[model samples]
Target chain A: MAGGTEIVAHRSGIEKAVAGLILVACAFYCFHALGLNFGSLSNPRSGFMPSVIGVSATVLAAVNLVLTLRKHRMAEADEVALDRYTALNLLMALAGTIAFLVLLDLAGYVVASALYLLFLTKLTRSPGWLVPMAVSIGATGFFYFCFVMLLGVTLP
Target chain B: MENFALLMQGFQASLALHNILAALAGVTLGTLAGVLPGIGISGTIALLLPISFGMEPLTALIMFSGIYYGAMYGGSITSILVNVPGEGASVVTMIEGYQMARRGRAGAALAIAAIGSFVAGTLGVVGITFIAPPLAQVAIAFGPPEYFAIAALGLLVLTNLSGGSALRAVLMMLIGLMLGTVGMDYMTGLVRFGFGVDGLGDGLDFIVIVMGVFGLGEVLARICERQNDVRVTKIKFKDLYPNREETRRSILPIFRGGLIGAIMGLIPGPSGTISTFASYALEKKLSTRREEWGKGAIEGVAGPEAANNAASSFTMIPLLSLGLPFSASAALLLSGFMIHGIQPGPMLVSTEPVLFWGLIASMYIGNLICLILNLPLVGLFASVLRAPMRYLMPVVALVTFTGAYVLNYSLFDLGVLTFFGFLGFFLQMSGYSLAPLALGAFLGPQLEQGLIQTMVLTDGNIWTLMTRPLAGTALWLGVAMIGWMIFRFIRQLLRRSSSQPVAEDV
Candidate 1:
């Protein structure tokens, strides 16, 4: 129970930290926006809307942060177990896509796409490795045929 | 009478062999896509957009319209049978529809939903066919201030009614607006926030951002959660029709839901979802079998499903008449129109009568097709719901990436897509709705252009915007809506504080 509470606290802390990062981003946006020329109201300039948006975003983020913190402070922490296995899989999924994007630029589209699919299918652990492999091959072949052969997408 | 003649011509154009084939293919693919959990109509359309690129404008549009109705049909199947809403609008259906399924009334529930959708969808198309032209005529007289007011109301209404904290929704919208400002300022020809990056100069691609935020974000979110097993009852064709009693119970709800949905559709925000909720609430209040609502009631399934379908069709009004997209799906359709080199607005009716009326006529055909396709194929689509997320998510991710890539073929655009995907996931995790953000991204430029144009015309008198009759009324209504939302939010917060101190879920 103590460990659960600690985990809840940790998650809350992460939330607050992210909220703080939003504030920082808004601040940076405002600062950067100031460099652009802000013309008069009748004749708006490049920075007019950006500056307004940045300030508004900053204020709203601040209010949300305060409300969140107050709510957190007022309540007893109840932990929901974070599914680390799924989380890791999700992370790997993200990594796999990023890798695919890079490899698509380096290797050809088919090779990169097939590899990405194989990796994702293995992670799924569905009917079996063979089925997934066949599915992956089929998916790639279909996409290639439809997009490149038929439509002439000129995919790199 | 002229409109009728034009519509007849449109039907003539649309009934061609190839167009019919395109519509059939679109609805089939759309229904299947909708059956697949987590892939919504917007995401599905975005994924399939590349394929439509080579086709003629009318043919492609007919296909898209088909997909729109078909996807709605597909969503209700999952919501009823599996208790997993395929998209936002079908969430209400899951409540009582799932219960009915559990009670061995899945067939009746599914049939009622399908029939209700067909009726409501056809009614909505009828409304659109008649109402849109006159609305466009009124819109033709609108000035920059009017545009500004309408755009503002659309954004404000969307944010307020997005089923979240108004403050958070507004913040997300502001962020989206800021992101929308990331490219060249067309007024002064000055780049605002590109920061010397070559790719940023042209601005972010709407499709890429949509694919990332909606498509990839949903996939990632699902992947991060533990998978749950879902069971759908095997349904035979003989069990497809509702009994006489069930049909009798459903009639009033379907009509009432359709009316409510059509009315809600005229306003922006999450109209489809909002209409379903409104229908459910109204039906529950008026139902003789009110006690049977959460347990399982024909009215419950009938009303919301009808409302959702009706709203989905009529929500295209603002887009067709006023050149404003009220929702993300409308925004995608707007992008589609643009891709075809056709601007959809008041001028659309006159300038491109064929495209305009053809698209409208296609809706009627599409609804009929959905009814025909869904009735027998609900079983097949229900089977699709059982596909593992592990296999599904990866394909979804690939489609999103490829869709984003095909838009501009820029690596920098890919980076923007990835950034927005991560940002969208985090924002959703924090309980912020994405609809407002997408709306802001869509309406931001229109709002800015209107403001600037109004200012130029009025010589800096912002007060003049409030002087125009229609524009002023809309602007004031938007303000009042926001004020009411803020007040309600405060009251809810106070009540929560006074009652039970709850942990911040984020």
Candidate 2:
């Protein structure tokens, strides 16, 4: 019988390989922690439903691995060269998020937000100091007006 | 007669200057974020949600709706100008829209979209004004069992929309149901899925998950795939509006699109995306000039764009009448009602008729504002597409962080945002369509609740769903949907299998 069809840069083998391994490891851990057997409708248990989830997840993971082996091969994605700069950009984006959080805790929302905006503006190779500075301030002021003044949501 | 007078008063109230300005602000901000890659409407709404907290409930809701519709419009911009369709519905538009752009008909394509959105949105508002109260009367009589039935029907509707992959959709829906189980149990209020984290006590914020999956994940995937320069040329001025002939050809599609949108909007669930996709598929299939489709056929852009906006307006019907929020935008608006300490249901009709009818009436006002602002600002919007990737990424990241943080003023929110963002990114990178995943997230909880309720009401006899007429019809409909999907799947497999030998033989 025919299985899954071919797709361009389709992720079958690699995804299954990775997700399968994680599923196996995670499912076992989850099973050990949470028991199966959610009691009858009269009495539901905490670990009851989770046991099914954990066990089923493990089985699904194993099934996925088999499907990957049968339906796909690594060579399908070989034509494409994985670019490096893309990875770097993603990392920068993630790191920037980390920094923004740290800054939010240290400074108030306005100051930290302004600084982060300026930094982001610079990444675009945005010309001129005025635009970024003006934007940063405007963003900060806007947030202050919206969060602090209106919603009664206290933003530090 | 007094009711008519009250309705008129609410309608006039929506036309006020402040409400107009608020709607303008929302759509403008929404378009900016929605047009941008990785900045989805949900994310923009979530980011702006904290700000909405401080505004008057009406102002907050108008702005929120603007953002929702604006994102729909904005999403089409990138899809047409570039090949990236920020949302799934835009994928259909992208087929014909970007093709039109590449051929340098971007202006006409965009013009059709704007006009179509206006026509549909206006009609949808009209529909809501007349239909909502009657629907509310029915909804008022609904018990928990009825709600369970509605949710079950929504799942059935979703199954038909799995883009032909029913199995994957079912699996995804189940996963969403499981994830929805993670917070404190609704009945028991018992802690679940806390993972020892205090933040998990309340469960993952729905908005947070949407942003991570739709906003941050999209950016991450783009970064991974587009390490090299990935800019597309911006659409120029002359190409902005469709010619007379194009407009003539598009009229019927626009009307049909509006009707579809209005109807879809009143439904419970993520009908915005579903409606748009359905319209585009229908439009493409019906268009006399089918070959023009995916070649940036103006109808492709017009139909879906109109549908999304119409749905946005009509969604207010159920929210105003029954206080039902099937989609995120409606939920956001529903939250507005709660903030004012006014529950939005049957009582909202009599109790807060002003707020209820005012918002509905304001939709007409909002439609006018959208036309005035959006069309004139197309050129300016084009410039946004030219923004370099580096700057866009960090801004999106920071916005994600700040938006999450401001919501709870907790550092833990940031952690939740980033972690989910990564998970979202991974899901995208792995080729699992996020649309189904997100749709499942929105629908799963409600479906589970419905299933449980239906089961309970039936007294442990799972077959009672078929015994009750309305609920049974819905159950049968759900089964039919699954069966149809299975049939489609088999057909697809056969088509693929049949075609394979030809390729090898060649």
User: What local lDDT does model 2 show for residue B65?
Assistant: 66
The residue-by-residue lDDT of candidate 2 on B176-287, one tens digit each, is 5456566776646667667688887887666666667766676656544432455665656666667898898789888888878887876655677778888888888888
What TM value does the first chain of each candidate achieve? 0.84, 0.69
Q: TM-scores of the models, in the given order? A: 0.95, 0.82
Name the TM-score of chain A in model 1: 0.84
lDDT for B42 in candidate 1 is: 79
Highest DockQ: give the candidate number.
1
CAPRI-wise, candidate 2 is acceptable
The candidate maximizing TM-score is 1
Docking quality class, candidate 1: medium
In model 1, the Cα lDDT at residue A126 comes to 56
Q: What is the lDDT of residue B185 in candidate 2?
A: 62
Q: What is the C-alpha RMSD of each candidate to the true structure, in Å?
A: 2.8, 5.8
